[model samples]
Target: MNHQERTHAVLSASGAHRWLLCTPSARLEEQFPDTTSDAAREGTLAHELAEMKLRHYFQTKEFGKRKYNAEVKKLKTEELWQDEMDGYTEIYKDYIKTLALSFPAEPYSAIEKRVDFSQYVPDGFGTADCILLSGNTLHVIDLKYGKGVPVSAEENPQMMLYALGAYQAYSFLYDIRSIHLVIIQPRLDSISEWECPLGELLEFAEYVKDRAKLAINGEGEFCPGEKQCRFCRAKAQCRARAEENVKLAFNPDKGKLPPLISNKEMGKYLAYGEDVAKWLSDLKEHALKECLAGREVPGWKAVEGRGSRDWTDMDAAFEVLKEKGIAEEILYEKKALTLAQVEKTIGKKDFAEMVGGMVVKNPGKPTLVKESDKREAITNKITAEKAFQEEQ
Candidate 1:
């Protein structure tokens, strides 16, 4: 497919999680121009590299070795190319191969396939990185290059939507009874999968349909929350979000400050903390941008912040420092390579075989989390002892 010709739908699959919650956000974001950062560019480059590797492996007839080598060389010439990306993309390709082996026969695999689900969602479409079909099961695989947050496939709206689209497109040709969604984040060493019956997927599709209809028309109340507002373009200026955060500071029941917060209430308050902090940061940035653009922002003006000095020539400065009897070891603090870096240098398989037995993971510090969290709760010894003493 000509990706350049493809236009993003108002109710796009990727933004389903956000738009489904805050239905108005999809339309509201249209006013803001889409901006790309270095991180986004790096992700795009990684995806391209991954796709190339998969094509070479799966469709060697179409993508010849010579062509693959030349394409990879061209990709390496790009500024964002990193040596680590090569290893990570290989990991993705290997995982896809393993998925293929799980099938009884050679599964029909497609790379960078475009699937359409416009029936449920108006003009809804997205590209699945890799998809495999065998017997009664269809696997929709996605590669998440970012390591900022580990993504899970369990009831994940984005993965579910991709599966829905792929199923819709290929159901006629295959008896697809089960749909499997997979999210692979090689950088984080995360591979999560969620499998469901066709009936359950269709139920999810109905849910998407209802939300997409509301989102397309900018209907439903603005429900501002942390995850939904994180990437919303209107997050900085949205009155609903501002109001929600403001309401978090006060208790509607008591119209006044409480002497102390109970432990039970603290969890609820802490949940709002991250959202409030992010909202304030985004608001400040927006105000600074407006001021920089010659617009008036009440009680705020753009000014040069404190700047740090840097050596004009680092190598020359370092040499002069060495000549002045400053010890090289003192000037440059040496540190051991991280586990991940060492693993990468030695090759993952070899590193694991050699030092995997030596590696030990200690218990992490106890952290407060919601009851619905998947992690098993760790008992705090002090709290347990205190409770036992009180009972005695």
Candidate 2:
């Protein structure tokens, strides 16, 4: 084992202590040929530790109460402890079943190869989470317990880097034609799979080699932006800090006439907004190209974007309650509840019976509503619906 692998072993062992463990170096960051900042390091570490704790909590039911109580104390809030526990337990059971069928190996939490990508030298190097030689293929599964959009495994630089390493380590012994890169993200409800062709994989290895040479020779500037900056630890000391103001301008809250906005401040905001828009457009184009560069899966299209939430139909809800002899006055006065809270509030059996045959209408689709648009849309919808009902 090299220095990186040794460090990972130490940290993984220490991670059993829950909160006291040190962070493991990200394989991608190590292979990137750029120095990562402390802030970025801290953020990544915190995310990993939270994932570890969540995994531990779900794996063993005996410590459920203790873990829940610890979370309550740490967060200093009594909100959603039981609900979270219930959801975690359900998901954990499902995942355990998935592992049993997919892996069937003895220890569920075993680390196969750590930073073992030395074979594809002068190209790229990465630490693989686990490599299971099942049947004819090698399954390289990377666990990303994060809540962000699942990392696409197809043409992923990190996965390719690991494949390069695997080829060097085991190509002589095994006739490996394909590298299976699987991202298991339980939190985001996403599972992504990518396969690498040997030829293309080698091409990417060359690209990595060229990039590393540029980075080492200081041939290119480290151009940081919102996407990368979000996780960058060196932001405070980074020269890019001055550029943040420009990025924040295009943020969701830009045009809102804040209670206080001086003319000078407004000018600065507008200037920053313009810069951010251009930067984001360029970033998106680059990412899209990188994603589709490798082999394509048959009948598999790029994922579609999901809409966000808007207002619920309170008036419709009231009408439904009225039909059930629940007075609007009483209903309006009572606290509103989320779907899950309602389940717990009335007990599962009663709640299920109450909504058994009822069809729950969704709120209208989400739109980018301006303040002016919000009032007009709500008024128009309510008025139109009322008028049509009256005519009927």
Candidate 3:
């Protein structure tokens, strides 16, 4: 997709979950405009870095042209264009080459290929980070720059649509047998994969075609869910989302308690606190917009958020720390090591062999969480001692 076409009317792969569930959201979103965000700018830099690394790997670009500058024109210096991004993009390039190595000849590889999924969704198109067309399989790799949310490969409509687009574009030349959808989240240090046979993928395409028809026409229902509303532009003012959150809170005017909850009831609404948190955040943002427009709400007024004092130059302040005879270690907090980063650095087998023994388990702090959380509950010391005595 070119610069102009990038913002056209299309059921974007990224927003597939939103339109598929809350079909009217696509139309409603047209009223709102896009805003440039820090996260979005960071993502742009990451994608540019990825493109440069991939292009240089294939020997298409000149040596000096491949270098990346953190400071873009009229943009603040990016802190993300360091060893982390470089290392991850190397891993991405290696993954593509490793898959292509198995082929008899040098397999065809494309970076940032503009894929058209219009066969399934109307005017649907997005750039695939990398596509490796090897023997009997098509590998579609997507590089996600965000670290806040971990994306999965299982039943991901966005990646699935990309697969359809890639298959349609290359099927004429290659006898493709399967489509491999992969999501490489570098910041999370995760590589998730999903494979679908040609037949099964086509079935999903048909489902998408029907959904796209309804979504484009605004004829579908406004069924709200966590997945659908997470990235919706109109989420702050969505009627359906508000209604869903209201259902969780009971009638306050009625008598105090609603009696005890059963096992089934507790399991269902255990994780709903996050939804309430989202509602509060969205409501405040909505009210702030009205306040800024000279339409103040009843009880709330616009107020500046808290800010911290900062040195004119942080490096100069750090130099002052050296003059005071403060140890560098005392001045700087060492970044903690994550399990994912460790495992990624060394292969799983070597990690288990070399450094796994040094690992230690610490008791996590007591937390009130949803029953759906995978972590097993850790009982309090009193309860544990009582149960042990009873058993004796």
Candidate 4:
């Protein structure tokens, strides 16, 4: 499968849910720089790996065994490559093969196919990880690499957009009457699929068209909630989000309440519990950044949180321990307690008397805390070392 470099649109299909729900976020997010996380890098690597294997499976002639082996070797050499990724990619490949077999005949396959849905979403386009078109069916498969959340294909705007794009691109060649949207999240051991008639898909496109116009023009309401805001770049400082969470946390307008909270109200509160916590965390992170940038964030300041310790030289440090008559077994067991855990178990006094001389402490990383926090306020000159092997 040939890979296509993904170029994100202002209203990209991947962020369809966010933009569709919080229509103004697309413009709001443009204020912040795009950033990638370690997890996202790993997911990209996983996609590369999965694409290589699937290309080999579907286009065996063009992507032969020797070429496939070379690609696999190159992918395995990636810094973020994990041993478990091999199994996960294999799971994805096997699922695709199984899906193809279920079709009446050999399906036409495309890997990392770029699809344009500009008709519905202005300048919208996204890469379909895999597309299998056969007879009357159009299948759009998406490989989700993250285990943190299990994405479903049922009415998933991202999957729907991809399916729409595939249909627009292939319906002329194939008598496509039905559409299948698939989410293969192997890490979560889930394979969710949603199928619909071509007519229903067209209706979905119309719905998207209405929202896309609002999103592209930045004319829609700033509806702030969890799902839509999860990946929004502007989430941390969005006034709408702050206001919504504030209301959720303290619905003072409810005035007087019953002695006991009603079950219905409790359920509603519980539903937004994670969202409220996440918003507060994001608020603190935003304020911390402002303070670090030399801006005054009224009641908060940055200070040293906690630092991890590590050995400058593991072998030399262990040698010192051996000289101190400490056996190797006591010092290792999947490398035993994380310093603090060990100290707590052995009693801090005993730990200090026994092994304290062998270890050195490092100051914690810069952190944001209340102005009244007892810890002394310090500049952002923090550092870190290997957690269990700090140099003495």
> Which lDDT tens digits does candidate 2 get at residues 1-392?
12112243211211212111111122223433444454434334333333334445434574476775574364334232233333433453355346546755532232335445433332234456555454445556665544655567777666666666666777777777767777666556667787766777788767655554444333454554444444433333343433554447535464557698787776666555653665555545434544477535454434557979854997887788899999768875656788867777765556668984674757876554323221345433567668899999
Listed per candidate, the RMSD to the true structure in angstroms reads 4.1, 17.7, 6.5, 14.2
Query: Which ranges of candidate 4 are over 4 A from the true structure?
Result: 1-5, 253-256, 324-392
The TM-score obtained by model 4 is 0.82
Cα lDDT of model 3 overall? 0.76
lDDT of all predictions: 0.87, 0.50, 0.76, 0.86
- lDDT string, candidate 1, 136-175, tens digits: 9999999999988677799998888888889988999999
Selected candidate, larger TM-score, 1 vs 4:
1
Show where candidate 2 strays beyond 4 Å: 1-112, 119-127, 216-218, 236-337, 340-392
TM-score of each: 0.86, 0.45, 0.75, 0.82
- Number of colliding residue pairs in each model: 0, 3, 0, 7
Q: Rank the candidates by TM-score, best first.
A: 1, 4, 3, 2
In model 1, how large is the Cα lDDT of residue 267?
75
Error of 2 at 124 (Å): 7.3
Task: List, residue by residue over 300-361, the lDDT tens digit for candidate 3.
Answer: 99988898997899889988998999877887897966986777666555777988898887
lDDT of 4 by residue, 1-392 (tens): 33324569999988998999999999999999998888988999899989888888888898999999998898888888776777778888998999899888898999999899999999999899999988898999999999886677888899889998898898778999999899998877888888999899899899999999999998889999888988899999999998899887887435676788787776666776768999988888988999889999988899888999998999999999999999999888874569867765665557789999998878888875435344689764444544334553
Candidate 1 residues lying further than 4 Å off, grouped into runs, are 1-7, 255-258, 314-375, 382-392
- TM for candidate 2 is 0.45
**How do the candidates rank by lDDT, highest first?**
1, 4, 3, 2
Worst 10 residues of 2 by lDDT: 13-22
Instruction: At residue 372, give the lDDT of candidate 2.
Output: 26
